[model samples]
Target chain A: MELLGYLGEGFATSLMPINILIVMIGVTAGLFIGAMPGLGSVNGVAIVLPITFIVPPSSAIILLCAIYYGAMYGGAISSILLGIPGASTAVATTFDGRPMAQQGKAGLALIAAAAASFVGGTISVVLFTLFAVPLADVALAFGPAEEFALVLLAFTTFVGLGGDDVLKTIIMICLGLVLSAVGLDLISGDPRLIFFDQPGFYSGISFLVLAIGIYGVGEILYTIETQKSAPQVTPAKITFRELWYGLKEINKLWKTMSFGSFLGFFVGMLPAAGATPAALMSYGIAKLLSKKPETFGKGAIEGVAAPETANNAASTGSLLPMLTLGIPGSPTTALLLGGMVMWGLVPGPMLFIEQPDFVWGLISSLYTANLFAVLVNLALIPLFVWALRMPFTVLCSLVFVLCLVGGFAPSQKLHDVWLIVGFGVVGYVLRKADYPMAPLVLALVLGPLMERSFRQTLIAEQGNMMAFVERPISGTFMAIAALFFVLPMLKHVKRLLRRDLSPAE
Target chain B: MITGARGKLRACLGGKVETIMLTADRVLAAGIMVLSVYFMWHASALPIGWNGMTGGPGGGAFPFWLSGIMFLCAGGIVLRSFKDSAPFAKDDTPFFDPDTLRSVVVVTLALTATVAALPFAGAYIAIPMFLLWYLKIYGKHGWVLTGALTICTPVFLFFFFEVTLKILLPKGWTEPWFFPLYARFF
Candidate 1:
């Protein structure tokens, strides 16, 4: 009854005229951004974040979440039509989506993707609502020791579970931490790491600068190399008959959709595994269980449904930790966390206590955003087919201009813009060398918190290093972190043992 | 027999042949090593050790230690690259194709030029110049399209950033021209 009361209040806040309008605009913008071949949710959010200051903080957050939801839905559009995954999250959608499009069922494939996304989003949002309160209640007990341990666990998860090269990951994490430490030392109030006595070093690097550089400028540069030739956009015209038929087909796959939603929700909460892996895993499992598994990747409707559902579910799942525990579950959520911090609505257990109205409003907005995203996606298929035909260079040019303006808009500093260029070029080169950018961005965002908590704990304990392990909550976190840190090494050892046994056999 | 053994050794190791990827990998690792040392040197400005008064690690301790770890990790990457079993050694691909590299280089240079001119020439002039170069000259789109975008983008940016958000973009020399618009809006 209490939950219901809170939810009713949330609906009252979200259904306001202005908030609904914001959601509609945000979803439309996100759809176009996500339908582009080289852009994704992170890029759309980073570029649009600076401009969102026109609205109040709570409304701005709602708008950003709407964009995130819409982008997840729009990612499947290009995957089915152009046979190009609009974002990394939608890569699995291309496997069967392209085949279905090739078989002249583009309309059916698109309708299925939209319906599946709606189901996935609806299921996950309900889970998010159920879990948010309990998670915050648990996190309310966290002291500085637990905070430090949790951040450590977040970093180790990337090293242990990420598919990127381990050495590169470590280097990026360290680099980000060092960069985060450049400005005023939180403890002593003294300036440090002032390189060449530049005045900009005094304020330190913003996560926004790094995000816009890597995801915006670096991404454009990287795309210019890979997307040299234009892709054919499969024309999709949706009729009511096809939509109804598609819904009926999707209705039959309730088991696959439900399983995918559950899998995605759980996996997405982990910092290491998010939408990409969840969608791939869901698709693989769906195929494995299907009676006619051979049809997968060859135009099976189930193939399209499985990944579309999972990716959308995973996106919502990634938001759970960010809002409740002040730890981002993915790179996009990290940016959202940064944005929230900038707005002075610092996301944590305290946020729920201090600002229940804001929390509920944002949560309920997610439900509305999901509905609008599906509606907008289904309605805008013809528009996307036309817009996707716009030359890549036009998109590249506009994005570059936005990067320049957006980078300057935040700090109004030429120095930051220069840093954006430098990071963009460096980030592009590093990406070419197969270095993962996600850990680097996450580390920068979390670096100050990790340092602050660690020092705070020590100060309270009078230099007792064992205080961290003495607290059960923090000790458990540290132990899990240790396990994650050693997981890759254990796998390596097992591989060596197998190699040795195989030689003898 | 010696040549054959050498050939087999080369094959076992990624190879003696130098590819762009191999060169890039070694260079990047070396660059990171240099960066780490530089960070450590700066970090030592403060106490990169336990401060008894504070009952904890000093401010510099985190960056100093983290940079040291970064140095070690980068060293490991460099060392691994030299080993015969290094991942990049066996399969060699060029870092960037020639045609694509040229295009990317051109775009990057144009972008850099636009940014450099932002504070000096101001955003209005610098941004439109970038659009014209990108759409008209590089993209070879029709003049109507280029002209329309070039004219329309700044107008939108002005209303959105300057008028609505009240966040003024750097006008540089063109600061005088915006006075009239600001007067009306303000």
Candidate 2:
């Protein structure tokens, strides 16, 4: 009941004319960015974050969240029309989406994707509302030890479950953490990692610089290489008749959508796996459990619905930990987290208590954003189709210009701009070598927190190394962290055993 | 172990040459190792050990230990690349095909040059020039499209950033040209 009361007040705030307008603008912009072949939510958020300085902090956050939702919905558009994923989260959507487009069912697939996304967004927002308070309550009991353990658990999940090479992932994590430590030491206030003894080292490295570099400039460079030729957009026309039929068809997949929503929410809460893997898993499971499994990847509607629901759900779900626990579940949310910190808002449990209006307003805006995303997405399909025809060069050059300017906007430093370019080139090379960029960005966002908590615990416990394990809650978290850290080794050993057994067989 | 595995792979492929990707894997790993050493050295500026009185590790300990781990892991990557069963060990594809390499290198150089010029030539001048180069030279876009964007982007950026947000972007020598606009707007 109290939660409902808070939610009502949140709606009061979110329904303000300014907030609604912001949401509309954000969703529309996000749709275009997400509809573009090479950009995704992370890139959109990173590039646009500095520009949000014009708005109030709460409205800015709402705008970014709206963009996140719109991007999730928009990602499917490209997947269906361009036969290429607009974002990595839409990769699974492309399995059936492209085939459907080819079969001249692009209109129906788009409707199904939009509807499924709405369902996912609605259900996940409900779940988020229910879970956020409870999670924050639990988190409120945590001390420095628990915080360290949780952060450790977050990192170990990447090592264990991340699809990238474990060594490369570890290297990236270390690199990001070290870079985060480049400024003054948290406790001693001593200058550190000041490469070339430059003065720019004093302010430390901003996560925005790294994110814009990697996702913005680096992505363009990577895309320029890969997208050598333009792709043909499959023309789609949605009559009202097709829209109604598509909605009816999606209504039949309620069970699959619900299942996807639940699975996506849970999986997305894990820092190592966000919307991309959640969508993939949902698609895989939907296929396995389908009445006509073979129909999947052959223009089946369920194939499109399942992943669409999951990815949208996952984006919302990822926001839970970031708001409640201060650990971002995805790179996009990591950027949001960074942006929030810059705006002088502290995340984690205290935020909910201190800024109920902001938290609940953001939550309620998700519901509105979802509605607007689907409506605007359907209404503007023709616009997207036309926009998709624009040359990639124009988009790339604009993004490049934005990156250079956006990089300098926050810090007003040519040094930061230079750093963005350097990071862009290095990040692209590292990515080519299979280094996972998500963990690197996440680490930079969480590094200060991790270090602060870790040293705090040690100092509080008077150097008692066992203090982390002795506390019951922190102990449990540490146990989980240990298991995650060893999970890859376990997989390796299992593989070797299987190979040996195969020889005998 | 390295030579033996390579010999087997070579024999299997009948002497198919390893591509630059393989060399890149080793080089990247080696580069990371060197970077880790450098990080460790820099991190030692602060106390890189535990402080008994404070009951916590020194400020440098975290970065120092993390760098040490990075070094070890990078070494492991190099070592693993030599193993017959390692993923990249069996791959024969080039890290970057010639076409990709050329485009990537050109764009990177252009981006770097633009950033270098930003403080000196100012955002308005440097950004438009970069956009022009990207669209006209590298992308080979038509003059109409390139010219429009190159002109319009600076105007939008100026009004949005300078007038609306009051975040003054660098104008360098072009600072005087913006003085009249600033007088009008600000």
Candidate 3:
């Protein structure tokens, strides 16, 4: 009953015209940015963050949150239509989506992606509403030790998972962490690496800078270097029957839907666990569990279903930790958190108690936004497909302009323009070298938090690392990290020993 | 295995294109590794301290640690390069065709030069000139499209950042020259 009342109040607040308009604008902008290759949800949110400074906190949060979800929806378009993934999470989608596009079912694949995203997003939002408060209460009980351990877990998992080469991913992550430490220390206020001795440097490398560099600039470089001889596009239109068939295909893959949603929600709840990893992991698990795993590389329907569902669910799931602990789970969430702070609504255990209307309003708006995304995507996929038909030169030029403007809009500084170009070169090199860019990008996002948490833990325990093991919650996290590290080594050893045995064995 | 001079040239430039690209990439990666090590060293040498009351370590501390880790990973990369003698292509196709490389490098350099010049010239001047040149020269767009984009780009930026967001952009010498125009509009 109390929950119902809170929800009612939330609906009332979200119903305001200004809030709805913000959500609509955010969703629209997000879809545009997200659909563009090299512009992820993080970039979309970061690019528009400065506008939030002028708007009310509630409106700003609503806009950013809507954009985050909208971008997730938008990412599927390029994956299905062009075989180019707009975000890392959508890479899995391209496996099946592009093949489906080749079969002239591009519209169907897009619809399926949109519908699955809506379903997954709605389910996660419901889960968030039910569990967010309780999770906050539980998290409130945690001490500095547990928080530190949690951050460590995030760093280790992010650096360890994904990519063909773990070492390269670690290197990229380390580079990101280093880049993040270029400004004044949060706790000590001492300047570091400020060669220019400028106040801009004092604040450190901006998230905007890193995001534009890795995703925006990097993507441009990749496209440039790998210029396809002939633009690989097929003009595919979907009939009503095909749309229905795609819907049926999704309905048939009910297990994929459930598994993706579950995995996405679970991972999303973990701090720093963003949509991309959730999508990738769910796709991997689906492949592992599928009877015909070989169909995965082909355009298997489940391949599209798993990642599409997972990314959406994870987007919603990320909000849980952000709202409850004042800690952003991903870059998009970080932008939203920044908005919340600007609103004077610091996200913590006290958020729900002090600002029930604010919390509920944001929550309710998410439900509406998901519904809006489905409608918008269904209507827009054909138009987006038409956009894919534009001349490559023209399209590339337009994209470059958008990137330049977007990169500069946040600070209105030329330095950011140079930063983006620099990052673009780095990103291009990393991509060429087969280094997973996700880890580096995520590391850049999570770097400062991890450093802060580690230092806080050290201070609390007077530099004694044992504090992490002493507390039950912290111990559990450390145990998980230990298990994560040891299990991989054990598996590698087992594989090596097995290889040593002859075929007769 | 004796080959004619022309055949040898073709094999060196065309037949062995994949090998050259792979070798180049490997060398680049090795260079990056060395650079990362240097960056680590430089980052570590920065002045980092914690204030009183057990304040946390300064910003340089995390970067130093990261640079060190990157250096180690780069070392691993160097080892791998030594182990893999044969050229490894990411895809089956040729890594670089002449036309693709030319187009990519031109655009990249153009974009880089545009960014580099922005600090000196005001955004209003830099953006339009870059857009016009890119559209007309590289893109081969008509004068109408080029002219429209060139004009609209700066106006859109001015309003989006300066008017709406209230963030100040570097006006450069052009600021004093155009102060009346901006002051009137703003």
Candidate 4:
């Protein structure tokens, strides 16, 4: 009965004309950003965050959340239309999506993606409303030592999870940690990386600058290098029959959808493990388990269904952790968390007790936003498809303008513009070198929090390294980290030894 | 043996060119590393005092640790670059692909110029101009698209920052001139 009451209140709050308009705008902008190669939800949210600072916290958060979900859905369009995956999570969608496009089934593929996204997103939001409070209660028990260990675990897991060159990933992570240090030290009042004694450096590297440079400008530079005369696209029109066809395809992949939604929810609960990895993992698992695994890369409907479902589900799932606990599951959610804090709405165990109205309002609004996104996408697909038909030169140039304005809008500073350009060059070089950029970004987002925890632990223990070992929660986390390190090596060594003993015989 | 000697000679010439590229990249990376260290040192040298806070650490503490870590990583990069035997690898693709290199350099230079001019020109003017050049010259876009972009971009700026959010953007030289016009509408 209480939940129902909250839900009704939430609906009332979300239905406000201004909130509805903001959601609409956010979804529209998010779609554009996400459709562009290299610009993901993080970049999209970061670009818009500065504007939000001036608005009411509730409106700002609603807009940001709308954008987050919008980007997750928009990523599918590019994967289906262009061979390039717009976001990392969309990489799996491309396996089938691109093939579908090649086969002139682009319209159907998009319809399937959008429908699955809506279903998955709606279901995950329901789960979030139920699970968020309990999770927050669990998080409230964590002390500094335990928090520090958890951060360490997150950092290490992210670094090792790259599955590429570990050295490069570690280097990127360390670089991010360094970049995070550029602003004034939070524990001490000292400036840590000020070059010209400017107050700008005191605030440190702006997330806007980092995001625009690495994702937006970096993408432009990359596209410039690989500039090609794109094949002319004839916009594929979807009829009522085709829509029904897409619906049938969704029904056929029900098992994949369910599995993906569950996986996404689980992954989304973890801090920083959001849509991208969940989508990728689900797609990979689906491919591995499929009866016709060989058909996966050749327009297998499951390929599109699984990732599309998982990424959307993960978006909602991530909100669970952020809303319940103060901790965000991804950078976008982190920014949203920042917004909530700025609004004077304290998250964590107290939120449900103190701010039930705000909590319920946000939750109910998500349902409204999801419905709005579906209607918007359905009506606008043709127009967006027309946008895809626009020449690359024009499209790329427009993106460049958005990047600059978006980058500058946050701080109204010139230094951020320079940062964007510099990071663009750095990102380009990293891309050329096959070094992954995601870990670097993840590190940048997590670095400051991790450092705060570390310093707090040291200060509390008077620089005693044994503080972590003494705390049971921290000890368990450390033990888990130790296991993470050992298990991989052990597996590798076992494989090598087995090969040495049994191979060739 | 004579053929092998000829191959070695060719290899030496190729390796020399590779060495030069590698040396340049290494020097650039090293310079950046040194700059980073200097920044870290400078940041650590500030007179900000730490007030003891229970949950939130003081401002300087986090930066100190992060900068220190960055400094270490930068040092590692420099060291690794020096230790590596091969610095560059020649492209297997065609060497004289002007479009590839030209587009990259042009876009990069354009972005750099935009950044340099932002403080003086302001975002409203500089961004539109950049878009115009990028679209009209490099992109070979139609006038309709270019004009639409140029006009709409500032309007977007107006709505997003000035009107909706109430955050102020840089007015630069045009602020006084356009102030009346913008203030009237905004």
Model 4 chain A scores worst on lDDT over the 10 consecutive residues at A159-168
Per-prediction TM-score, please? 0.97, 0.98, 0.85, 0.85
Greater DockQ among 2 and 3 belongs to 2
1 or 2, greater by DockQ: 2
Question: Candidate 1: global Cα-lDDT?
Answer: 0.92
DockQ ranking from best candidate downward:
2, 1, 3, 4
DockQ of each: 0.79, 0.81, 0.42, 0.38
- Tens-place lDDT per residue, model 2, A1-505, is 9999999999999999999999999999999999999899999999999899999999999999989888999999999999989999999999999999999999999999999999998999999999999999999999999999999899999998897898999999989899999999999788999999999989999999999999998898889888878999999989999999999999999999999999988898999999999999999999999999999999999999999999999999999999999999999999999999999888999999999999999999998999999999999999999999998888988998888889889999889988998899899888888889999999999999999999999898888889999999999999999998899999999999989889664
Q: Interface RMSD computed for candidate 2 is what?
A: 1.0
Please report how far candidate 4 places residue A99 from its true position, in Å: 2.7
Error of 3 at A323 (Å): 3.7
Candidate 4 ranges with C-alpha deviation above 4 Å:
A1-5, A269-273, A291-294, A338-354, A485-505, B1-36, B43-99
Candidate 4 residue-wise lDDT, A347-390, digit = tens: 66678778777777788878977887776776688877777666
Candidate 4 chain B lDDT trough over 10 residues, lowest sum? B87-96
lDDT for each residue of candidate 1 in A1-505, tens digit (9 for 90 to 100): 7877888899999999999999999999988988899788989998888889999999999999999988898899999999999999999999999999999999999999999999999999999999999999999999999999999999999989987888999999898889889899998889999999999989999999999999999999999999879999999999899999999999999999999999999889998889999999999999999999999989999999999889999999999999999999999999999999999999999999999999999999999999999999999899999999999989999998889889888888988998898899999999999999999989999999999999999999988999999999999999999998888899989998989889664
DockQ winner between candidates 3 and 4: 3
DockQ class, candidate 4:
acceptable
